[model samples]
Target: MVENALGDANSVFSSKRAALRVLVNHGEKDGLTAARMILTGIPLDETYLQNRLSIPMNDEKKSLKGGRIHIPDSYYLMGTADPTGILKSDEVCIILSFWYMHQ
Candidate 1:
């Protein structure tokens, strides 16, 4: 990750594992705090992400022609604001608190 005098501006490009660590750690401390951080931190370019990873960025439930499993709301999507200050429909993240067992 690249760093500047201002700070780690390249955090948006950090690996998924690193991002997950931050998310999980913060979540452990506080769910709302973690959710707020993720809401403000993740800087994904919707078009680029869609074209590169073939992942939808919205909370829709429509099925993709190739597969019904590809419904827009099938997975937790990341969201962000547009230039006009409107929240993008596709940029969303789900936060849940629950227990899990490691195998």
Candidate 2:
């Protein structure tokens, strides 16, 4: 009975470890994809994007702030705030998304 219990526990641990490995790898891929979309999908120039954006905090930190764009008389674009700088417009909203390694 003891041997069987030990074997079962080991098997469960191995399975869980495999599942976690898969999740970590998927998170890395997702982070890269989000980073790409943010860089190319936005209308902003490459240089501007680099200066305005911060690097991923970790492999799981990949995110895209605004995928939706609004067009109008004045035009609305996605932007983040810099505490030390000024915002050209009076209207500013903040949004955040957290990417998890698992699910």
Candidate 3:
């Protein structure tokens, strides 16, 4: 569904290929947060870190504000393990958080 959505030229998400790939590779929640961060061009900060790359649960169940793409829970699980052994979940999160902070 996500791959198909990305192919639509008229879709708001059409240009967000990289972020979508991250979404597919990772999971919807983190992927969406990363995509928003990319779109907003906002540097990671204490506030964002405190929030932990997640849309608030109440807000998440409904549609995302501003008509952003929302991946339903049925499409993916709450958590995903990395297929490759290159990094553990904590390590990956730490690296991403660090990279985002430094940027």
Looking at model 2, residue 12 earns an lDDT score of 26
**The best candidate in terms of TM-score:** 3
Better of 2 and 3 by lDDT: 3
Candidates by lDDT, descending order: 3, 2, 1
Error of 3 at 44 (Å): 2.0
Clashes of 2: 0
Query: What is candidate 2's lDDT per residue for 17-103, written digit by digit as tens?
Result: 322322333345544443454535643235543332222222212221222211222333467566756655665655533352123
The TM-score obtained by model 2 is 0.16
After superposition, the stretches of candidate 2 with alpha carbons farther than 4 Å from their true spots are 1-27, 43-103
Estimate the TM-score for candidate 1: 0.20
lDDT of 1 at 95: 50
- Model 1 worst lDDT window (10 residues): 53-62
For each candidate in turn, the TM-score is: 0.20, 0.16, 0.23
RMSD of 3: 16.2
**RMSD (Å) per prediction:** 18.2, 19.6, 16.2
Better of 1 and 2 by lDDT: 2
Point out where model 1 deviates above 4 Å: 1-12, 28-103
Each candidate: how many clashes? 8, 0, 0
TM-score, candidate number 3: 0.23
Q: Which pairs of residues clash in candidate 2, taking residues 3 or more apart in a chain or in different chains?
A: none
